[model samples]
Target: MNPRKSDWQNLDLLLKSFAQISSNFIYDLDDKKVAELDVKLIESHLSEAGHDFADVLEHLCDNIIPQLSASRGPRYWGFVTGGATPVATFADWLVSTFDQNLSKDGDSIASEIERQTIRWLCQLFNLPDSFDGLITTGATASNFLGAICARQFAGRRQGINVAQAGMANLSVEVFSATPHASMLKTLGMAGLGYKNLIKVDCLTGSESMDVADLAYRLQVSTAQTKIIIASVGTVTATDFDDLMTINQLAERYDAWVHVDGAFGIFERILEGENLSNGLEDVHSITLDSHKWLNVPYESGVFLTRHLDVLFDSCDVPAPYLAAEGDKPEFMSLGLENSRRFRALPVWMTLLTYGKQGIASWVKRNIDCAKLLADNIAQSPNYELVNDCKLNVVLFRPTCSGLDQQAADEKTTQAMKAINQDGRIFVSPGYWQGKKVIRAAISNWETQIVDIEIGIACLEDIASKL
Candidate 1:
């Protein structure tokens, strides 16, 4: 064994480490501090410190979390992160203590717990009871698997043997110019090259693709086009695309409609039934629990309408695995054969707070985002960029005669100034070729005062500029 953690003492130490990490209310959460502590460093030291994970983690706790948490402590606005709920954090510790392996049907009790949790997620989103779900690393990998499932469905329809012989009569286009980076990366994973993406005059001519525009594009294109990836939350301002409209387009063209709802799935669960008009139309969706649900990091979920499609995507037959006439297995459905019970913390959070509490948590940050938008809209020298669709607000300075590049530079300076001041942190992004500050309000613990003070902090920085 590399470093056998024998009993509860090690687990207690682990819990204490996390608790100490959480006690620091003011942390930056720097991306660089994390980048420095990657696998190469671990692999380099694995031989040197064979039975010393405790020592390894001790070093990281002393140097890493302290410096890294600083990045996200100042109103901490980047990549739609949510401060971990206390119940969820505790549950995560308990889960690690248990050390569950959530892979197979007969492997362990952890499998059943995760299976139940998957069912809970399906019900939470009002998806079909028969749907298959898996907890993944994050939405990126989850999205890729969903796309792969779609690829399998498309190939099976053509009798092409794509998993073995590979895709041929398909261009595998996104059909929308405005796609998340996941689309490009998913294209690579699905054996559909990025060059195959057919930009359909989106992110430029229209905010979202209309049915007429989609039909027109598909008319010009051949049957080689197989998949059409759609976005639930666009990266810019968390604005949700019209899925009902996209659903119609995908159906008429017989293209697989995979909805990349990484950060946006909570909008359906937490926003209630009225906000989700036609959510059931998409073939599949991917969710990120860490973003809005606030259950520590790396608890992403993938769900599909056709359970068979999901289960069939990773069909593996091993003689030692199961008997010739055993029950239908769940592990065969996902990307991995050996996975952690990552669902526990999420399930624990849901079990503790229930749906209403999660709704309140999501709404609190959303209201906070709206609060900042109203403040930004009222500011004299600032210009509001886009509608506060979900928990993201986009704004920029109203300094006239400045080129887009210069405006972007000014926005960057404004963001850094606020961060360095150690009061607030906001990220810079582009919207319609204009430079803007993007504030993502997904943190469950972020207060109303944080929003007010953050806006004031922005005003202070802008005044200096």
Candidate 2:
């Protein structure tokens, strides 16, 4: 029955539902059909039609739970990381139950806790304590924020107010040939046309911006030009640009250095205590928790040394809303005025497992690729495109007689053949204009056996092709 007013008793029902949701994540996958569920159900029933909260729970248990569980389970390694640890999942449930407003520290306990969370995160990644970071929607928004901050930081240097004067008046370039899709979004959002931006020649076998090319461009580039973006972990091979070199080049050019390290910053924990050399030099760095840290869904961490620059880029003074106070609220932070409680899950993971745990999980995936790449190199049929430095292993079957198109077709055919079986899933993508299978091992739950299954599946498909 519908409650007359606020329905304070609904909290009991909500906790009950939350319990079931948490319990669903603990079980291993099985072949048995998860109750009687529609394989292609699409319609949602109205409350009057008997699709109550209980019915919805049944539907989730019978449908959504099994699919995501199986699709993203131990043997699944496609696209990139999207696995939720058990503790992280529980933390997410707590956030849902409390429903704490996270936009400002004045909202609730969760808000203040978020401040503490960011402090720990900044320390964990060795980000400057002075460098304040806000949890963004994802890496794409994080990249956009970094781009905006770069524009502002650079504009201020040139005695121009970018916050007051938009990108309409400025001529800016990202200075990257191989940039993440978010980089394009960043530029496009900033009123910089993608086509107008220069694509400097990449170093070799990748789209990573070249330091030498950057230096040459800076030598010729005029004074009014905007920022240059340096990449850490190219999407294709997870290749890292020489950030040290890029910082030096940007310094010479007087361009703001924005580092797009979405999945790359986690590499910081793996490579000794100093993850990013000269990161403090860069104006901003973009981080993605879902990719490497294995959080639930889209959660991005954007950190900048110059907090005033970022604050100016996204500050909104609602005279009626923000009270005149000493402590600037989080709403003055970035693009989001109403932010999600994403910090709960992320903070929980870091607190429960610690940095070493995440570092170890990342190492397992790296080791898997090392083993897989070595195996692929030894095999007669496969050709390793490059050295496996991180978790990604890009390789193609050695189609000796086939033409370029035919070779690509073979790779496509191989991917289709393997995915049809549904035991494992891998996607095909281009590398240096050549068709290849890019196996990125980033899921925290994925083990050595899962990697073996994926390798066997790839080999089996290739042999048949």
Candidate 3:
């Protein structure tokens, strides 16, 4: 009996069983452990002669599924992770079933769907029709795309094509006050050494860039070509750089402005927020659908008005691949020649929820963060590290009667204790040279009740410390 043919014969039954298993896990996510695993037990399952597909499925249900981290759960406050909505999950499954390589048009409707999704995203963000974009594999790739465009634009200004000439003798200066780590990695990948990043001074007691300092640096800088990476929402504090002033400075200095709005762009959906007022003036922007859009993993987008520069930077002249014409040939716009139909989930989620639903989700998550911050402020055991900005709360456990060093150590201990408690999950980091616990309220499922639970877990752990 050939296992492959046998599995094919029973595909329907196998798929049904798989769906049931997935449904059970998602339905029981609230009660499941946040994270659990035994490395030795997992290693024991590996064998040279694999079991039948049915046995493998049973093993996954019995062993692997139980040990996975429940990052999709409502109480997961780490890493700014977003949980997939039901419709989005369903759309993702459809994407897999269709399995279209969304590199070019004329093959399938996937390319058209992606184009429409991009246009819809632009409208949702109030961006002008002048902007064009392509979906990518999360913020890393999106930022990389932005960097590639910036490199091409800068090189063109110097009468050289960096993509064709390579980065042998050219130097491009990048300025940023609080660039995300991924942006730095993008610079490195784009042949502009990360070490060359000119660190502009941030505003006092804030992660936002200081416009005056940036102007001063730009005035003094001698680099022929420059790029400015502006942050819409910083990771640790959720603070936004002054994009309006930054764009003015970029214009004065003839610098290409790239806004890394990965998770921060959603904040614009909330009424009365002007943090992203000058977003349209920027040359390019990066947004992560997985972080705040409540979609599945590995989805992001890079938008730019300079489509010509993006094409010149990333396009590969191959006769087999179609050239850009009336429609976008996605392969020429960014990385990945054979790309997944990631836009389907985004498109479906947007269609189901519309703008109002997304706005409500963002506002609720911000409210949860604010609730946690208020609780931390009232508690004597924990100190609020920063004012709750957007949807991230930064705080630390107060260790009375201890020196600074000892207090920092205690903060780390408290963070560990809270994570180990498993009722909720939070991450540890340093804020202004002191240890802090960062609770990033990003999941659409997260609510005020989950924040209350987090506060309780924090209090319980702080009491022990």
Candidate 4:
């Protein structure tokens, strides 16, 4: 028999083995080391004639699994990652099994499911029905979509078809106060040149944009077409820009506004907080599902009110892929022409856990972050860098004997020690010119016990340092 046929015959056994290994690894994740690797030894396993399917699975279990980090575990606080919900995980497996190409609308139900999911998401965020959206790979891709639409809007304002005629000799002015790194990367990738971005002065003692400064700059600006990026959540401190004021300024200046609400848009779901004050007034928005939605990786969504501009920016006309009826093909919406069924997990998770369930998750995570922040505030060996806002806590190592530079060094060392201890995972970052450790508590699985474990890890590391 051929290799493909043999593998197909043994698929049941392979799936059984995979289930066992995955269950064991997840059960022991709390006690397991985050990562264990020997690069040279792993490299030695590569060979010309590939091994059998069973042997390949065995090799993966033995060599590759140990090197992987438990980033999906409750205590993994690095990169603001989220754990996959049970229903989402099951939906993801079905997505892989079905393997539907979601680019076209007429072929399967995937397109409709995606459409409904997008509608549901818009409702969840209190967006108007006029907003059109598409699922993308991640926040970077979503931000790229927003950039493309913004560029298109700017070009249209200047009487230029940038997609067809090119950005030659054209300059679209972009402004942001504390823009995310992904947005800057989008500027470069969108051919706007990262150097063209105008860095607006932030509010004193805060990462949020200074409205008066922004107004002054906009009034004095000479560029005909402008795009303003408003941050929903700053990376280090989780500070939010004043979106209402920024949108008002955008309207006054005739600028296209894009809100990078990657992880912070979920804050809107919580009651008594108008965090997304002017979200509905913006031209475009970028939201990440993998971060706070507690879905698996490779899921983000970009929404815009300018469907015509989006079509002008992203559509590539072809006779073979002609538009069918009134519906727009998913392929003509964003970067990828062959999209995966990413909306399944999101749809399933949303259905399984309605608005109330998601709100509870967000509230619990915010409480957990506050709990950790309180511990850090009361500790003598650590300094709380920023007030606990939403679900992120920033802090650094500090002692009476250490100077500024010495304290920075100690923070770095302590961060390393805590991560190496492997009971929990946190990331190192800089806040306001000083090195700090940032713990982003976004995972649905994270609880009070996990926060306590993180606290214990920090205390132990501080004592050792």
- Clash count of each predicted structure: 14, 1, 0, 0
Which tens-of-lDDT digit does each residue in 1-465 have in candidate 2?
Answer: 667646767777777776666565556453422122234655865566565667778887786766553544555556676577888877876777777666666546776667788788777777778777788878988888887887887677767778887655565555776788778877788766566666778877766667788778777766476577777788887877777888877766677878888887777787654446777678788888878888878688888878888878878767755635665567777787777788899889989999899888888888987988998898887888878888888888887898999989878877667666555666677887889877777878878787677678767877787
> Residue 382 lDDT in model 3?
89
Scored by CA lDDT, what does every candidate get? 0.72, 0.75, 0.87, 0.87
User: Residue 135 CA error for candidate 1 (Å)?
Assistant: 1.3
Judged by whole-model lDDT over C-alpha atoms, candidate 2 comes out at: 0.75
Sequence-dependent TM-score of model 3: 0.96
True-vs-predicted CA distance for residue 101, candidate 4, Å? 0.8
The residue ranges of model 2 lying beyond 4 angstroms of the native Cα positions read 1-26, 30-39, 43-50, 62-71, 271-275
Candidate 3 lDDT over residue span 1-465, tens digit each:
998898589778868996898899898998876755233355665578878877788778787788787898788888788888888888988888889998888767889899999999998899998999999999989999989899999989988888899867666789999888999999999988889899999888898889899999999999988899999999987888888888888888899999999999997777794788899889999999998998999899999999999989988778878665675588989898888999999999889999999999888988888988999999998899899978888888876688879988888788778878888888887788888888898888987778777888888887787
Better of 1 and 3 by TM-score: 3
Candidates ranked, most accurate by lDDT first: 3, 4, 2, 1
All models, RMSD in angstroms: 4.2, 3.3, 2.0, 1.8
TM-scores for the candidates: 0.86, 0.90, 0.96, 0.96
Q: Worst lDDT window (10 residues) for model 3?
A: 37-46
Worst 10 residues of 2 by lDDT: 30-39
